[model samples]
Target chain A: MPAEGGQQALNGAARRALDAVERTGRACVDSISAFGYGAALFAESFFWIFRGRSIRQPVRLTMIFEEMMQIGIVAIPIVTVLSLTIGVMLAIQGIYTLSLFGAESRVTIGIALSVTREFSPLITGILVAGRSGSALAARLGTMSINQEIDALRVMGINPVRFLVVPPLVAMMVMLPALSFLSDLVALFGAGVYVSLDLGMSLPAYSDRVIEVLTVNDLLHGLGKSMIFAVLITLVAVVNGAGVTGGAEGVGRVTTRSVVQSIAAIVITDMLFVFVVTR
Target chain B: MGVEAVNSDRSVLVEVEHLVTHYGARKILDDVSLKVYEGEVFVIMGGSGSGKSTLLRYMLALERPTSGSIRVLGRDVVRSRPSELYELRKKMGVSFQSGALFSSMSVGENIILPLKEHTDLDLKTMEIMARLKLEVVGMAGFENLMPSELSGGMLKRAALARAVVMDPKLLFGDEPSSGLDPIVAAAIDELILRLRDALGMTVVIVTHQLESAFKIADRMVVLDSGKLLVTGTVEEVRNSSNERVQQLLNRRVDEVELDPEAYLKRLTGA
Candidate 1:
């Protein structure tokens, strides 16, 4: 009887282990499937953006502008504030760390390179993901629940074209602009800190920044911002369009969109850094 | 259901054959087959969870069935490419139970969305068309209002305007009167009939409201537990002798017939 009991216990442990393995497998499959769907959505949105006019379904300029206003213009203040703070913090930190070696003046290279190549784009991406990505998810989720997406389909308006493409074009236009603005503001912030704390003149600081920074640095940050924009839009749309279960489902997908977008941005940033730094 | 009476002269617009659908392991539509004739008001009526809405979705080509075939406008919706479906959908319009107007756009913009997408018509012309549709739905001069600013009845009217704006050959309404007062429901019924008569669009409505179904439908199908129970005119359905149909019509609840062994198993979580 004791032996039988031990066998049963061992079987239970094996069953639990199997269940856990199955769960992990299921989660991985779900993520892969989600990624594939997002890719398809991205492809379709671009197809519509580029080829819609041939079929008399030209992407509406008005809708794109409206989306630009929502996703880009409305997000300006927050992006500015956050970028400025990051810039100041980076200057302070760079000064302190370099001062340990009595090389505080070279903080110019550090702030200029880091802000242009990394901090500005990364911080702006996070802000947009939180601000616009969550809203996009919630809006599309509510539309799914309300059957507006279905209505659009039945009306012969491809939801991807009518809905997704405008925001996509807006993001393409706006993210780089926002990132560029973020870069400038952040540089100005760092310059302010350098001038006030280190007794550096504004023009001297500007000359140092201009001397150290390359056009590639600015373009590289802009490129990363555009990539992040696509990532945010894709993640937001996938979660939104997949919503079910009414209002509660909308809320759930919105949260998931923001969380997933931030994760995507960070992971992609790491990959980008690896590639560039290599 | 009398073998789905065939009208030899009328062209069939929608035909479903041996349709089967499953949500996970549970069958939601079980080998259901039906046809919708052109230029008729056909209603699909069933209680909640009877797969009526699911059937409507299939007919709309919004979802793929697990098995069986659906043909809409002579196109195999299940096999059609997205471009083909879009072309087919241009001739079809659907109004969802919740109205489903784009919340970001005003009613006028929502109504003319189809025209904007598919046509290069002048903005003035589109606006005029939207206003005309709104007038037809008794929502005249309300085009500028947003969906969230409207009442339930007004919202449905706006949705109807949007649906009929393109003068689609067929119109599908899912439970148009499910959540409204009798007066408003009756008005919606009148609007559906008006749209049919005025625009010559065939109508397919899914509803469980017996009175509304009976009032609006020229012919109808009754579904129970994913199985089609009957397909006939209102009078024919009223006279159906099937026990379940009678139970439904008379509002009688089935008495529980418990199997002692099964009950014991359930109680013990066996």
Candidate 2:
């Protein structure tokens, strides 16, 4: 028993030493990774701030606009449909549960608050993370793996300006727009359910929602959506640029980016809720 | 053999001294030193995993050395600031092994990316420059095609056009003939030699293709196991008695197809 205990202690000590070494090595790599991402973000932000002056070509503008349209306008129908479906489900559940308390009128308020404060932005962000963020990461990751980023560097073009900036700017601008659109669709769907299914007048439900939901609610949601946009795009760029191993590495990074972005959005939402409520 | 005469010239385009590179715990390049003079086609030849590409990266300032110094165009590439590195890279050009064209853009846009980024040339002027380079590389009229639309050889040509679009004083190519047919590879080798002659540009090529290297290299360096084995003109290298060099240079179909058992028994006296 003593020998077994001693052997177990030795194993634990060896594990601890191994873990300490891994942590120390990974700390350096993490710092390097952080610095690379920081540089990319800084370069992207700088390009956007001075885009009009820096990018003068008409073709470049067309490319930027086309990308924005693909990311924002083309995605609207999916976002709207998904949000509407979610809203309908929430409304049915809310009405059915509230009826047990003989307080079905509160269903409108419930739908309004839930959709506005959490569901709309969260769902929209996840959609964007899965769809747009993954696409961006995969595209850029392939480019990095193929040495196209090195080509840009050799050309004296800041790759962050050329590759990361336009997409990032478009994403930041479009995600908020998508979130706003999603809120409208969700609210409208919820209203439809309340009016037709629950026998409540549209005017009465909307009035009740407006009365309960202040402007601060919309702003808080939008604020959260904006941060989610930033985080998704940042994770996409970091993972994309960090792709070192090839096609499989790109796939892994894209999956990690979407998962990390969604997780970050949820955590950020919690903090945002706390801040807004306080 | 004549290191003193080569060092006498102040027109060294690239100089490396005692370079060391490590990937994780494994050393990839060890104490490597070489000098490339202006207007020379310096070929770096080695088998796979011999750190030929690593040396090119260090020379281009794409990767920093673990120890020792690299000077490219009179600027220290290893320890330069970001802005300094960016500025120094302006005078240089590189064509990667994969061609590395922006897949999203047309060949025309890929060729003109450098002009668009660094120069103040208007659209018409940039277009003209792009056309001129395309014509130079025998890739004229393919500008509107996307990278994905082009064949491997055409992509390499387009990448080469882009690399020389700025009329850089030095050019670096990593495996320029890789993944291309023999005819196309030979054409590329000829184009590289012609470009050197016409522009008087220093060309440093990292390739494992012995035939292509022999055809184009004015001077060649061979690396084995992360260390330089020999460096000399092709004639000197072919005549050398170094066993590894002789083995590598003499590797032909007849030799490789010999019965391994008999050859080993005969060679090893077993």
Taken over the whole model, the C-alpha lDDT of each candidate is 0.91, 0.86
Query: What does candidate 2's lDDT look like per residue over B177-203, in tens digits?
Result: 988999999999999998999998889
Clash list (residue pairs), candidate 1: none
Could you say which candidate leads in TM-score?
1
Interface RMSD of 2: 2.6
lDDT of 1 by residue, A10-59 (tens): 99999999999999999999899999999999888878878998887888
**Colliding residue pairs in candidate 2:** none
- Tell me the lDDT of model 2 at B49: 90
- TM-score, every prediction: 0.96, 0.88
Candidate 2 wrong stretches, greater than 4 Å: A1-64, B3-10, B252-270
lDDT of 2 at B260: 88
lDDT of 2 at B118: 76
